[model samples]
Target: MDSYDIIIVGGGPGGLTAGIYAGRQGTKNLILDKDLAGGIGREVPEMENYPGYENISGLKLTEIMKTQAEKNTEIHEFENVLNIEKNDDGFTVKTDKNEYLTKTVILATGSSHSHLNVPGEEEFLGRGVSYCATCDGLFFQSRDIIMVGGGNSALQEAIYLKNLGCNVTIVHRRDEFRAQKHLQNMVKAEGISVIYNATVEEIKGDMIVESVVLKDTKTEELSEMKTDGVFISVGYIPHTELAVQLGVNLDETGHIIVDKEQKTNVEYVYAIGDVCVGLKQWVVACGEGAVAATSAYHDIKQG
Candidate 1:
């Protein structure tokens, strides 16, 4: 089995950042990702909130980070980590392709998109319903679509769809948007229709998505709306299965519980990014990654 000073379990911005810092600390580390290195951040069409550039795609930003990280540490993509077992010295990480032993482990396994959990949601997943606009926006061009959510991601995708010549309508359960003021403003500026105090009761379609059943939160009245497709951007649910396997503590919401230094309840183990409780932002994840790496280095050096 290959061994490393540190092993990061996700290659998103957080894990990549950790690898960079670990390398700088002169620790032999490796990053393992199940899919592409960027995770869901790459699905973002455009990100305006991240520091540095005025406007940049999430793919581009994470790509830059990935490049820098590769220079520092070894990153293996398409490696699905199946389990982590604590040992006397550290931990044994078992993946589909290989096994690795590390003195410390940093779990940066981000989050996945939350599903609507309504009828037809699963049945018509690719036929009409999608969680990533950048991935499926082109197919809906010039078609009418409904965006479900009130967050920044929802509004951003709504704008992207609108720009793609799709007549976009935002169906949010809240009266007001939860997105940033700038994003809300852009939504209005783009003339995207919004249905407030409403939620998707069901996604109805035959071979493909044809319409949706919407329920009003205030009045409890259900109505049907016509649309070619439904894009769900509600939010993300943190990926904490690995944390659970390691007996790491989690909050009420199931996010990994980490201290100020990003240390988990288990010794020689830490977590960062969406898997940890905090503002689920790229910048925040990057910062936590640095902290976790430094903490791991200090602990390893002390012993």
Candidate 2:
């Protein structure tokens, strides 16, 4: 069985940053990711707020972080973590491929895309409904589609889709957008149609997405609009199954509860990034990762 001083249970910016800091502290650490190391960060089309870079794509940013982390710690991609158990000595992390022991653990599992849960959504998942514009935008090129949500992601993806010549229309349940001013301006500048205070009541189609049923939140009036697809960019749900199994405390929203040092209620366990309750930004995740790694180093050293 492989053993280490710390094992980070994700490979996103947060997990990769933790690996880098942990390695700098001379702690033998490993990073395990179920899919690729970037997590949802890869889905971001562009990021302008992160420090040190005026403009960069999320994929490019995370790729750079992954490269830096690889120089310091071991990272295993495509390895799904199944369970984690605490022992008298340390902790055991079990994955689909193998298991390893580590003195401390950092949970950076991150979050996943949220769904509308409306009718016809599940049935037309691959047909025309999607959550990622970067991954599926090309499929709807020169066609009409509706973007659901009002956050930065929703607006960003809508702009991306519009740039791809996909005639993008934004359907947000809120009257005002929650995205940054820059993003909102970009949407307006792109001439993308925005339907405020409207939510998707149902997605309608035969084999693929043909139209959507929308309900006006204030007026309580329902209407149908023809479309080629539905791109949902509502929000995200934190990944807390592993945290729950490991006895980590979480907030009402299922985000891991952590202290300033990213230390969880469990003594040797810490959490960071979107999995923890905080601003879900790449820079914030990276900061939390550094703190968690430093805390783990101190704990291991004092022991």
- The TM-scores, one per candidate, come to 0.98, 0.98
**Per-residue error at 45 for model 2, in Å?**
0.4
Question: TM-score of model 2 relative to the true fold?
Answer: 0.98
* Count of clashing pairs, candidate 2: 0
Quality of model 2 by C-alpha lDDT: 0.94
Flag regions of model 1 displaced more than 4 Å: none
Please write out the lDDT profile of model 1 over residues 102-190, one tens digit for every residue.
99999999999999999999999999999999999999988999999999899998998899888999999999999999999999899
Global lDDT of each candidate: 0.94, 0.94
The 10-residue segment of model 1 with minimum total lDDT is 47-56
